[model samples]
Structures are given as C-alpha cells and as structure tokens.
Target: MPCCKTCTTALYITAPARCSPNGMKYLLPVRLLLLTSCLYRRLTSASTMAAMWPKVILFRDSITQYSFKDGGWGAVLADKLQRRCDVLNRGISGYNTKFGSIILPKIITKETASNVAMVTIFFGANDASLPEINPQQHVPVIKYKHYLQSMIDYLKAIEINEERIILIGPPPVDEKAWEVECIKKGSTLNRKLAVTGEYSKACCEVADTNNINCIDLWTSMQKVQNWSEFLADGLHLSKKGAAFLEETLTPIVLKKLEYVGLQFPYWADIDRDDPAKTIEAYNPYCPSQ
Candidate 1:
C-alpha cells in the first residue's frame, strides 16, 4: 500500500492506471530510450562539424624551418594545428617566391596529393635583398609589385581558389644588425637592402588588391621592444619568436577555414605580447638550452 501511494503520486502526472506494479517496469525502458536519442543527436552534430573543417598547407622559408638555432614559426603552427586539421609544412631554406612558384606545384602534388583546402604563402625576405631593389636604389618598385602579382595569378591559374589563399608579409629585419653586419662584411648592398617595413607594406597592398588575406608580421614585430625576441638573427625566428607568431595568426587561420565551411580543432589563445614568458628557453636542434 505504501508503494502504491508513491506510484500513485508519480502516475498522477500521467495515467494512474499505468502505475500498476506490472506497468511500472516500462519506466526504465522509456528512460533508456530518451538517453539513447539524446546521444544519437550529439554524435550526429559532432560528425557534421568534423566534416566541415578544411585542411591547411603552409609555405615559407628558413624562418619556418628552424634551420638556424631558433626554429621556424611554421613548426609551431603545425604543432598547434596537429589535432584540428592536417597542417603540412613545405618550407625550404633560402628560397624566395620565384623558387616557390617553380616548386610549389610539385610539392603540392607530392605532399597533398593535389587536394589542398587552404594555403598560406610567406616570402620576399630574399627577393627584397636585390642590390638594385632597395628603397634607396634606382630600380623601379613596379618590378617587385609585378613579381608578387604574378605569383598570385599563378596560384589562381593552378586551380588554387583565391578565397583559400592567405599572404603573410615578412617580419621586420634588424636594420641596425643588418647594417653592422654588412659593414663588417664589406657588403654595401646588404645595408642598402629594402627596408623591412616598406617591403611588408608593399606585399600587404598587393594581397589586399588581389582579395587575399594578409597578416603584416612586420608591423606586429615592431611593437615588441626586444626585436631579438622575434628573431634570433636579423632574419630568422627563434622558437619563442615563432611561438608568438603562431599564436597571433592561428585565430585568423581558423576563421578563414571556418568561412569555407571547414571545422577546425580546438584553438589555444596565445598572448601576442608575451608568448615566450612561460616557455622555457631551449634550442631547437641542440639539447642544451
């Protein structure tokens, strides 16, 4: 009779006749059915999101390779993106976009199997090193602009969608270091190389006009008081520096891929102002710090 009272209270919300001892057994089955339905919906939504995320490919130079004691930014980026989507690093040491244009297709063919969802192109440090192309040189700026335009055009022609391409401007070089090194080495032209700021701005302009995403790392690096934090040498990135870059750019990369209906894995928020604050100082190749 006590059991009947509790059952009657539960059944009052529904049908009292159904609260019979024999009928009470159906409650467990009903609860199980509801739980199964909820889980099924959750699984379906997760699968759909996973199918929507895009695969990314990165192209860069020595700064991305860590050939120097400080490793490249691309390596950090690859590690960050390792879980969410496929990140392929195709960076080579000492190569410019001219070489990039020649070899990118081959690399894509071999590495990506010709199926790239997005590509990030970073170059021009070496190209801007031309003797006659520096800001002070008499050479026309149009030539440099033309080279960039051609690279963009070639990417479009090779079946890479414009929407899927991002152009990252080079980071600032240490002008004083370059000047001192050039002087020590008696290389006048090195001192006369294109100003890092000017070259980066020019590249951004081209990317803007061509409807491609551009991140001006030159401007970003300028805000850091210690330039050495971003580049161990005047030209390449240190591990801490590369981590800063990856943190700043990863959000943008995820947004772009999302726009293309691609799902990306989790993104870690990195402080652009102090990426190296928590990281232990360690050489990329050497075990000794």
Candidate 2:
C-alpha cells in the first residue's frame, strides 16, 4: 500500500507560486522547468510507474461465455467497472472443471498475474451433466471437487491470493425447460436440478476450505419465488437473471474497489493557462501523495 518512490518524490517538487508581479514575470519559465523535471522522473521510473489497467478475470463455462450477450451479466459488470478495471472474459463453452484446470495456467500466467485485481471462478453446471446421457461433459462429483481445489491452488501459486478470488456456484436448473431443448436435439434431459445442486454445494465447499469469497447462486435463486424465470434455457441465465446477478455481484466488486480511485484526473481539473502544471504533477498511481 506504500506509495511509489517516483510519485512520492514528485509531490515535493514545488510549492504553489504567488501571483505577485515578479512571480508572474517568471511563471512561464518556472512552469516549463517543473514540467521537464516531472517528465524526467516519470521516464526514469517507467518500469514501476507505467500505466496499466488492473483486470478482473471472469473464468468459467458456457454461462460465463455467453455473459456478454444482449443484456447479459458480464455486460452489466463491464459497464459498472468501465474505467476502474478491465473485465476479461475467459469463459469457454461446455467446459467442466477438468478442462478448466488443464487450461487455467495458460490463460493466467505469471506475467499477467501482477495486474489481475480479481478473478471469479464459475463452473459446475456442465460437470453435473448426466454421465449416462452426456459422458463428454460429465465429471464425477469427487473429481469436480478436486479440480476446483487444484485451480484455487494453482492461482495462489502464481500470486493471485485467495483474497482476490471469488467462487460462483452454479445456478439452479429448470429441468422441464431444459428437457424441451434436449428433445429438440433428439435426446432426453441430460441434467437434473438435484445433480446440479450437488456440484454447486461442492463449489462452495472448495471456497470455504480455501477461505475465499463465494456467490451461492444455486441456493440463492432457489429461494426466490418462481425461480424458473431466472433461466433462459433451464441452464443459462435470462435477462432478468442477469440483472439479479449484477445486483448480487456488483456490491462485492465495489467493496474490492473502495480504495481504487479513478486512473486519471478529471478533464475539468486541467489548468487552462498552464496545463502542464496539473498534468505533470498528477500521480494516478499515488493520488494521496
């Protein structure tokens, strides 16, 4: 939390000048000197003080992959976090935790980990697929738990600590509606509400074991009256459901952002007569300094 050295030094570069006649005569030269000095300091410390957008990675399955659709939950999040953070969609369709575990390292590497402010792990619906009907996407309950734990462990290894991670359990399924979709493909229902609840429970267990945050969508949606309206195809979220997701998740994301200020000064704050004075001294990295 300590301010960077470059910004700390920049703060003491000058004091406010008086508006006396002598001060006015030297104002232009003083402004140019201050600008030059500030530029030099910033350039010298570019490696550590360079501008970079902190990221919030949304890593999950089909539900997440389609979160940016018209009026989707991901789109809502992106809008809420416009300038403060970059919300990266790393969702892959039809992915179970097994495949997610295999590819997580490649998606989030050591190089990118430094700038990652947060990550949301959302999976389980696909893993809970009925093995007898859809063996390809179905994963055993026990292995699903293992895969979740492994992913959490791997993220911590790369320095994205548990504090920055959020586990989102699967939402409740509308078995009857999903069955209709299955019938269109010449198949019977391949998912059950009870089965998905098991995976959702397992997702929360991993989160609890690691002492990270969790969004138990499965339990939450089920508590609401007429929960079926929350889903589009018994599995994916409807527009109403996406709004609920935003309402639930936005508070948590905002809590994490309490200490993060806007990246740059407001346009109106730029001094018209001496723009360089404000521009050179403004330290987005260390607003307090």
Candidate 3:
C-alpha cells in the first residue's frame, strides 16, 4: 500500500532516502518524541540561565528615579553590569529616610534578599529640607541618621550584609539656581547647600559606623570649580552629574562583583552543528540526567 502524505513527509525528514514505508512508520514517533524532549529542555534551561544573573537594587530618592533618564547614572550602571547582574531601580521621588526605612522591608524581603548582590541606600535630599519651609518633606538630621542605621540593620537581618550595601548621601544644592524653582512654587529657597551638607555628613558617619561604603555626593560635586552645573534644578542631577556618579559608583560595584563572571559561554563557543551539546552541558534538567 502507498504511504500516506503525513508518513511520506516524516520519512523524508527522519529516514534515509531508501527508507521502507514500515521503517518510516516506526521512526516518526521516535523522532517526534526526541524533538519534544529537546524543546522542553531548552525552555527550562533558559529560565535557569536567567535566574543565575545576580540583582543590584538601586534603592534611593529622585536622583535614582531620574537615573534612567538620558545620561543618567542608573543607565550607565545598567549598561556596565549587563549580562552579569540585573540593575533594578526602586527610587521614589521626594522620599526621605523616614519613609524609605518604612518601605525598605516591604520591597526587600528575606525571600528576595539572597539573590541581591548589591543595594544602594540613597536618600536624605528631601530629609534635609528646611522644616519651616518644607515641613512635609523635612526629616530631622538626627532622625535621618537613626533611620539610615535602622535600614542598614534591616538589610543585614534579611541577609544583605554591610559589604553589599552602599550609602549615597544627598548632593549639593545651588541656592541661586534653586531660588528660581522656589519662586515658581511660591516659596523661598527651601533647600540650602549648608543644610544638605549637614545631612550628607550624617550619611557618611552612618556608613562609617556600620563599616559599609558611601558616596558623599554632596562633598564630591563641590570639589569641582562649578558644582552647580551638576544640578538640573539646583537639586536633581543633570546629565553631567549623573555621569560623574556613574564613574564613582561603577568601580565600587565592580569590586563587589569581582568574582562574578558572565552568566553563560560566549556565543562563539556554541556548537552550531549540534547546539544540543552546548545546551545539555549547561542545562541541569537535561533528560539524560
């Protein structure tokens, strides 16, 4: 009897040119089974590969929120750590350490902390606001220090130790430039460089007491001839300022992740002829096992 069209197609694909009709009938089922198994293995292996990439959480205020903007520091870090780790931004605009401490636990729980390779605690810009001018945002410098310490303690409790934490203090403000913003909002200058310096100093003290790293943006930017250029509205970071931050933070991040390498083999190492060989080697759920 003549083979059916389905069988004929399977025969051409899976059997030799001289394959008998009976042989095609037997080979098709085995070939289909092997193909299905390979596909399943590839799917599971892809998920496992993704899970292997560590996470770097950027937990901060508007600076970090705006970090993904053009020329933003967060974008720079994301590019620098691509394939090695996932850079997650958890920035909240106008948030102070008091609110940040309250929210940190909700975001970084014990279940998810183990996967975090690094976390940046960047706050205090809003906290340093003058209470008389910006009562809603202002957090006392003393409370700010306690809040930061509490956050560090919480992260440690959840397994994110001091070595994996970095504190970024508030950046310097430009009174001349910021006054324009304050006027637009119907208020006199609500943030002052001197007040911000006080908070930044407190941030460094906390980092020192906890024995963790810190990026004193307030002091670092002022070292330049015209630091105000770094501030977009005499508060937020401009592109240049963001780049400066990226340059400073990248080295520390690299040091922390020195031992971690690329997640998988380079593309050139993949075997094109039998890709399954490479896939199976890396796949822990390979059927043969």
Candidate 4:
C-alpha cells in the first residue's frame, strides 16, 4: 500500500553516516554553531526559496499500478516525495499514450494548481500490446515515436515545459515467458507483439530530441538476474520488483527536479560521483542473491 518497511530499513542501515560537526565524534558546541549557520544559509538560499516548490504528478498506466502486489513504485516514490512536495498518482489501467494524451488534459484541468514541477510519463507497455488481443494496438516503432512526440507536444501546448516532463521507457518484457503466457491465455496475436529494446530506443530518441528526461527501465531491468521475480506476469512488476524500481529511480528523479530549481527531499545517500557507494542489486527479489 506504501513504501516497503523492510526496504526503508535497509536503506537507512546501508546509508552512509551523516557528516558530524566535530572531526572526532559528536559535534562540539563551536562546531554545532557553525553547522547551524551553514544549514540556515542553505535553507534561505535563492535556489531553496520555498515559493518555487513544484507539485509532481505521475501519469502512468496499468503496469505501474497492476495491483497491490505491483505498481507500488509510484506509491513508494509518492511516500518519499510527499514530505517535500505534493505528489499525485494518475495511473489508469488499460490505457496507452494515445488514451493518456486524451485524458491528461482533463487531469490537468482538475489539478488546476500551477507550478507543476514534474510529470513522469510511464506508458507504452500496453501500447505495445497487439490489437484483437489487448484493446490497445501494436504501435510500430515509428508510430510509437509519433505517439510519444504527440504526447510531449500536447503537454507543451498545455503550458507544461518540455524540460519538466519525463519519458520513462517501459520495463523489459520477457519474450519467452510472454509468448508462453499469451498462448496459455488464448491470445496468439499478443505473443507476436511484445515490445523489444528497439521500440524503447525509439522512445528514448524522442525524449532526447525533445530535451525531456528519459528513464531506461528496459535496460536497467536487464541487468538483474531475477527479472521474472519482479513481474506479476511477463508484463507487470511484482510488489518486490516495484520497490526495487522505486529505490533505483527516486534519486534520478530528484536530481532532475533539482536541476530545474525545484526543491525535494533527498532520498538516496550515495554521492553522485561515488559509484562504489551506490546500491546495485544482483537479485532484489531474493535477499540471498
């Protein structure tokens, strides 16, 4: 329903200790005074001006909120962001970019508050599903790009700056498992239309050309040995898988928001330049891995 308690506990346990005021152990009185002064300055800086805080809205589909066992990434991200800003989930199951483009305007109208800092567009998974099998069509790579670009244009048309939009590529589909599952479900057409990396690359190109942030969930998920463990089916993430995705994504999202002069709480502790300190999971679905 929210962030995984175990995951949060693990994050804190693995986090590097906060820098102390004293060179030895705890902060001395003099060090504490200096630290407080620094903190005050940081809090009052031009960049940290509270008025510019941005509201974040996530525009995704079924895969992002498949069920209680999956789609928890959005919830997890919302949990971390709720402390710093207004976070809303606008995920609609069985919708694609085409439908999203149609409904997003209505959502924008409802969440009429200005100063929208970020909108994470996580679609294309269902769009990649074939017609006659899934209600959504099998959008070819070229058409898919057009659909994505159209969505971007729609946002810009509605006054959402292109830089504030994020295009999240769909997570990798297990081709073998997908085919098997589709066949079992009597959906032969879908078995032939599962998405591939080339489709994802097209989406990335559109995002890059438009100067929007692109989160490559496809390639990122490929590195994990236990990819199936995260998926409810071949198409959706498992609860554990969603938590892992959230853990991997929050920092990147926060950094992007920060670059645009939006303020949000820092959830990840790893230094940007320090790769070794970064958390890399071999198998987040299983602790032993």
Candidate 5:
C-alpha cells in the first residue's frame, strides 16, 4: 500500500492533510481499532482495546478556539504529535471563568478523562474585561482565580492529576489598538491593558497554588518590546502572534509528555505484511501480572 502524505502506512494509518511544521491539520476523532477493516478483524482475538490515540485537550475561550487557525498553537501541536495523540479543542468565544467553571465537567468527564494525556486551561481574556463596559464577561479578579483552582481540583477528582494540567494566563491587551478595532465593530473599548494584567496575574497565582505549570502569556509577550504585533486586532492572536505562542508553549507540553510514551505502535514496530500482528505489543490492556 502507498504511504500517507507524511507518515508511512505500515500500521495502516491515515496521514492528516495540512501538515504544519508545528501541528496537524484536519485531525478528526478516530479510534485506533476502527482505522481499517483488516486490522479490526485481526485484532478481534484480543480481549481488550485502547483508544486509537491519546488526547491532548485544549480547553479555553476564543484564544484557544482560534488556535487551529493559520498555523496556530493547536494546529502546530497536532503536527508535532503526528498520529501519536489527538489535539482536542473545546473553545467557546466570549466565555469567562464564571461560565467556564459551570461547563467544564460536561466536556471532561470520566470517559474523556481516562484517555487524556494533557489538558491546557486557557481563559481570562473575557474575564479581564471592564465590568462597566463588558458586564456580561467581567469576572472579579479574585473570583477568577477561584474558578481556576476549582477547575484544577475538578480534574484531579477524575484522576487527571496535576502533572497533566497546564494553566495559561490572558495575553497583554493593546488598549489603543484594540479600541480602534472595537470602534470598527461599532462598540467602544471594553477592556484596558493594565486591568487585564490583573486577571493574568491571578491566573499565574492559581497555577502556582495548584502546583501546575503556567504559561504567563501576559508577561512573556510584553517582554517582546513590540508585543502588540502578537495580537491580530489588538486582542486576538494574529498569525505571527499564534506562531509566537506555539513556539513558547511547545517545549512545555513536550517536556510534560516526556513521561508519556507516544500512543500506539510506531511504524517500525508494526509488521508491514501483517499490520495487526503486533496489536497486543503496545496495548494498555492485559498488562503483565
């Protein structure tokens, strides 16, 4: 059989299109056993099955939702992981910590939690909004941190563990530039740079308290001298900005994954002529007694 666009089809796997130097493009939710009918039948003798791919969940607001756009952070991770893991995104625009805490459990339940390799909690952009201007999205700085901690603990209850969780603070807002974008959208500026920093700081503090790794997007970007270039409309990440974030975050996630071996059997580990011959080799089921 011919190989996938990027990866060899030795193990009967499909290669994702839009392969970035950093992430995977057009990665759908696929189970390993369901990859092909031949392999599925060959593995039927095995009594247990593992998820085709482990998952790295991107849980956050709009910043995360747009991560798959234009070689963004999310897209880049998919590429880096190859078919080793699935980069699952659950981003909702205009959501703050207040609403996020309520919806967190619904998406990350015991079932989803079991196969997860890591989860990134990125929020606070909307929470950092000025209450007077963006009341619906505003979250008092103190409550914002509380909600973050609450989420960390919730994941722990399901055994996701502290080591697998990462917290990301809001990026620095460019007040003047964002104001111009707001006006173009027929609205006044609803956020301020200085005030947004508070929520970002709070996010870092929560990460500290929980002993979780944190990506301080606010401080890190501001150090760039011309940090405003990182934002597309003075708020959302532009292509350059997304690249910056992807570069900064890559090492952190990779380091955490050092302890986690790649998912499934590597191409070399598979039997080229009988792809399913080694299905039980890397299986999580039937661990040695």
Candidate 6:
C-alpha cells in the first residue's frame, strides 16, 4: 500500500496538462488527485495567461446567443481559433444597451477577465424598436449611445481596454419581413430598417470616438444588392448572413488572437512513446500570427 501511494503521488505531480475525453478512466480512484489538480490549474489559468489556453469573449445579444447554432458565426470563429484561444460566449437574448450596461459587471470580473484576447460588443437590435409601437424594448438612440459607452467603460474597468474591443453594430433589418413576425407575435411592426440604420451608425460613432474596432453591419449589408437576405426573422442573421459575418471577422479575429497562447501541445506534436519527455518539451506559445 505504501508503494502504491508513492506511485500515485508521482503520477499526480507529473500528470499531463491535457486529458482525453474519457477523463482519467486510465487512473484508479486512489490516483484521482491528478484530476483535481488539473481542474484547479485550469480554473487558476482563467485569471491569467499561465494556463494552457487564453480566451476571447463574445459579448452580444440574441445574435451572439445563437452564434453556436448550426452554421453560426460563433462556430466559425471557434473553428478558426482551434487550439489557439477558447471562445467564451456571453450572449443574452432580447437585450439592448440599457439592460446590457447594467449587467456588464455581473458577467465578468477582473479575476476572470484577464488574458482575454478580445471582446466583441454586439447590441442595439431591441433598442432600435419604434418608441410608440414597441415601447418595451425602445431606447432613445442618444441614450443607446451612452449605454454602449458605459458598457465599454465597464469592460475597461475590468482591464479589457478599447484596444481589445470590437463593436458590432446592429445588422440591417427587413421591415416588411419583421412586421409579419411582429404581427404573428401579437404586436404591430415596431422596427424600421432606416431607424435601425441610424442606430448602427450611432454604434460606429461610439467605436470611432473611442478609437476601437467596429463592424458596420448595417451599411455593409446595404451594399450587398439584396440586403434583406442577410436577416432571419427580420432581426437575426440567416446562415449566409452568419457566414458573411464570420468571413468579415475571421481576419480581424486572427489579428487579435495573435496575443493569445495555446493551452497545450497538439496531439500530433506529442511523442506518445516518450510521454514524459514530450511534457518536458512543452512550451506555451500562440501560433495565431
């Protein structure tokens, strides 16, 4: 029993940073200290770049919430950043700048916000709702601007500065299609493409004033001859629209991910015949550039 515990302790200290999906099935219960240590190390890394991987946060509304769905932009980003950075989705449905600004601090903290490569702020759809027609989500364009800036300030307080932020303006809406959707949900048409455009431009203004990155979805979509095809339910993005957004962001995201480092060595990079030697050779580095 003494020899067994000694062997287990040795394995625990020398455990590889990365583990298989089956978990420590190869390890007996007595040797589970390896698992606990691995988890604790991962948790600690969340606050600093000392972990196996860095993270990028997607902060947005419904558009971001549905980002991981099939053919969604989030999935595209994840694929592009495989083994480079972990993408943390912090999306909420039906939220605008007012509510988003209030919940900013709750979503992230200084401890968990460290080592974040970039954060994408995507909002304004609900805020663009017509005042008299859709009062529930209506936010004055001017107030919306302030709320966005406030959110940016909150991020900065968490150590995520403007240099690492990307503001995604509300995408162009299809008024005719969206009106039908509103009626089906027991409400009149409460949003307009033109008005939504104004909000998008306003978002750009904030990004410009702060000297951060901005993706003007509104104007960019309009440039496409059939901008309406980009929208699903007149508000969200269709698959093609998601693809467009993904393509637009791929290069930009890659550029920012240059700061992130790989969490662990790739399987192919490891020498299975000499596991101990492979672990010793591990180096923390990012291949994004």
TM-score per prediction, in order, is 0.60, 0.81, 0.79, 0.64, 0.79, 0.78
What tens-digit string does per-residue lDDT give for candidate 5 at 24-120?
4233333232233224322333334344356889999999998998678899988997655688889988898889899999989865665677899
Given candidate 3, what's the lDDT at residue 31? Answer: 64
Model 1 reaches what TM-score against the true structure? 0.60
Best candidate (score: TM-score): 2
* True-structure RMSD for candidate 3: 16.1
Considering lDDT, which of the candidate structures 2 and 6 is the better prediction for this target? Answer: 2
- Which window of ten consecutive residues has the lowest lDDT sum in model 6? 1-10
Which 10 consecutive residues of model 4 have the lowest summed lDDT?
Answer: 280-289
Q: Model 1, poorest ten-residue lDDT window?
A: 280-289
lDDT of 4 by residue, 108-222 (tens): 7522423465788887787777655675556666777887887788776644657568888887776666777778877663723235576678879998899887877778777
Model 6 over residues 113-136: C-alpha lDDT tens digits?
A: 655667899998899999999887
lDDT (C-alpha) at residue 71 in model 6: 96
Better of 1 and 3 by TM-score: 3
**The CA-based lDDT of model 4 is what?**
0.62
- Residue 7 in candidate 2 has what lDDT? 28
lDDT of every predicted structure (CA atoms): 0.58, 0.81, 0.81, 0.62, 0.76, 0.77
Query: Mind giving the per-residue lDDT tens digits that candidate 3 earns over 191-285?
Result: 99899999999999999999999999999999999888898999999998998899999999998776455655556767999776775465322
Residue ranges of candidate 4 with Cα displaced over 4 Å: 1-54, 67-71, 110-113, 131-135, 179-184, 189-194, 259-289
Q: In model 1, what lDDT does residue 160 have?
A: 61
- Model 6: what TM-score? 0.78
lDDT, model 2: 0.81
Residue 269's lDDT in candidate 1: 31
lDDT of 2 at 277: 73
User: For model 5, how big is the CA root-mean-square deviation?
Assistant: 12.9
